[model samples]
Target: MDNASLKKRDLAVLWHPCSQMKDYERYPMTPIKRGEGVYLEDFDGNRYIDAVSSWWVNLFGHSNPIIANAMKEQVDKLEHVIFAGFTHEPAIDLAEQLVAMTPEGLDRVFYGENGSSAVEIALKMSLHYWQLAGKPEKTQFIALESGYHGETTGALAVSDLGLYKAPYKPLMFDVMTAPSPDCFYREEGESWHDYSLRQFEKMRELVEREHKKVAAIIVEPLVQCASGMRMYHPVYLSELRKLCDEFDVHLIADEIAVGFGRTGTLFACEQADISPDFMCVSKGLTAGFLPLSAMLTRESIFQAFYDDYEKLTAFLHSHSYTGYATGCAVAKATLDIFQSQPVIENNKVLAQHMAQATAHFADHPNIAEVRQTGMILAAEMVQDKKSRTPYNWKERRGMRVYEHALSQGALLRPLGNIVYFMPPYVITPEEIDKLADIAWQGIQLATKD
Candidate 1:
């Protein structure tokens, strides 16, 4: 079918997420037919580079043969089984590998089907652990201002982003928010470390006063992807870990978007030399081949509810597809690729190329900041560069960039007025250059009056 026909049919039956349906009158959806090696093709033979990694999931590339073949073999043997009572080899092997590979002390794993569910599991587990340990009053969660975790009820409650959580405010549980250590708002002469330290003071005060009722203080580590990729110095995480230890609180690291080599290291927490009580991982866990999420916690937390059924100490949580065989097989293949190949080392070189390519944006009049975190690069559009005054959201400046990029055979999705590039690990330097060029041109068109 042609693009128009497919889009028409889709509009009639489908309501897309994270979008207003009425906007489709002006900005229609692109009907993708196939994807291969960082590029997606339409039914009419048009191709666009799969930037943003299809919502920051695809790692090796689209239709990666290694992961695809692993899934194919697993489906032939056992597609899935009831994970509650029955066991599977793929799940067992994947769990073992994850425990061995993740940071020290996170030896136990709990499976969920998506990032949001993984977050919910972490929240519930933390609350339950506190409750079982005779601290039933420790029921509140503390999240960073401008942080975005996931959209489930419990996850959404802790998230502070207004775009997603504002309308549903009445439905969510109250949460305490700490001032974020985002370095984007640092003053003219202030160093990132200095600014981060100053911001850490606010959280320190909150934890000191509210540690008794706070279950856990959740953070996104070095980069907060969903809130326009807001980044902070690693020193902030180091200090936060110390505070959590001192306050006797659990620290939950939500690495769903930044894990699996998206950041400079294998995991962002490694940069701070800290291990959180609960580490939620997904997205790239299966290399985008299947749905999977794992909440890794220390054995101490796992031992909280280790009693018999009569005592009612068992932590009850299960999803229908928890530890799914095919998902586990693909996740194992993803881990294997990381183990066998120098993915982190190669990413360092590509990250440098991306930095150099985007350096020109610093001179653009409407550009406020050109920031990067490993493979992720973002250009923030502004109304005044001197004061870093952001453009009005209703202006839809980022949407213009998206449209321009689509017209140029590139997919450059934006967050508010920020256009970001987060391509697959398999993307070549040549492809990086193309993406950078398109982004630069698209920004110009977007900012032009």
Candidate 2:
């Protein structure tokens, strides 16, 4: 179909995520035809660099041949099978590799179809684990203010972001929120390290008060994606880990966005030197080739539900495509690429280059803050630097910068006034320069006109 015709059809028949349909009049969606190595080509053949990793996936860039070949081989052999009654080599092997790569003590894997599903699974697993261990009163979870888990009802219950969960509160379960790792908005003159410790202190107090009812405390580790990429010091997470152990609360690390080298480490939790009781991982797990998530847990937690069939005490949750052969094969191959290629080391170099380039804008008149960890970076805009006052979200400064970047052939989707980058690991030092140049240009266009 012609591009115009397709656009008209889409406008008539589809609803998109995080978009105001009325705003489509001024900002139309680009019809992309092809993508490769961190770039997208439109239907009319205009090119744009994928600076956000196509929503922070596409780890090896679009369609790496190794993963693609693995999927091809798997589909030709056995596409999918019922995961409950059957098991496969790819799933078992991938799980084994994941267990080996992850921090110590996490030995069981539960596959779910999406990030939200994985989150729900983790929450349910944690809650059920406690129930199986004879603590049925522990059902509530401790999440962070401005934290985002996902859109599912269970996941939404733990998330406090109004943009995603506000209207659904009537149907959601109970959750208590603590201060996030948003150091940028912390009290003036207080160091981030101090701020982090205080936040953890409050969380510790809350868990102490509600230990009987709280099942788990969930976090995004180094990068809080939906809350504007808020970063934190490792000391805070280490203390949080200790508190969880002290209070006997399960720690769930939602590594959906920060896993697989995004944070310059294989997993962001690694940097903190803390192993959570459960981890929700997806997004880049299959290198953006497919939708799959795995909620990994310690063997102790898994063992709680290891009873005979009649008890129904067994954690009974299953998805039909739980161990889809193709996804498992692709995930396996993707993990192989991480070892055969210098993905993590290469990202360390890229992160350093990004830091140097982004540092130039730290003093820009419109820039309020530049926060980064590894390849992940955020540029927060504000009206008053001294006060750290953010522009009114209603004014849409972030949206403006985003549109300008799109017009200039670079995709940098901003979260509120925070324009950030989470580029593919394959990006070279030269491309890093290209991204910074375009980002600065977009900033100028956003502010000037």
On TM-score, the leading prediction is 1
lDDT of 2 by residue, 1-449 (tens): 55577788889999988889988887888878888888888877778888898888789888678888899999999999999878999999999999999989889999999899999999999999888888899988999888888989999899878878878889998889888867876787888888888778888788889988889999888778888888887777899899999988999999999999888889999988999999999999999999899999998888788888998887778888898778999999999998798888888888999998878888888888899988899988887778778787888878787787777788988888888989888888887787788788777666553
Single out the weakest 10-residue window by summed lDDT for candidate 2. Answer: 440-449
TM-score of each: 0.99, 0.97
| Deviation (Å) of 298 in candidate 2 | 1.0
Stretches off by above 4 angstroms in model 2 are 187-189
| Candidates' C-alpha lDDT | 0.93, 0.87
Full-model lDDT, candidate 1: 0.93
The numbered model that scores best in lDDT is 1
Query: Over the stretch 284-367, how does candidate 1's per-residue lDDT look in tens digits?
Result: 999888999999999998888898889898988889999889999999999999999999999999999999988999999999
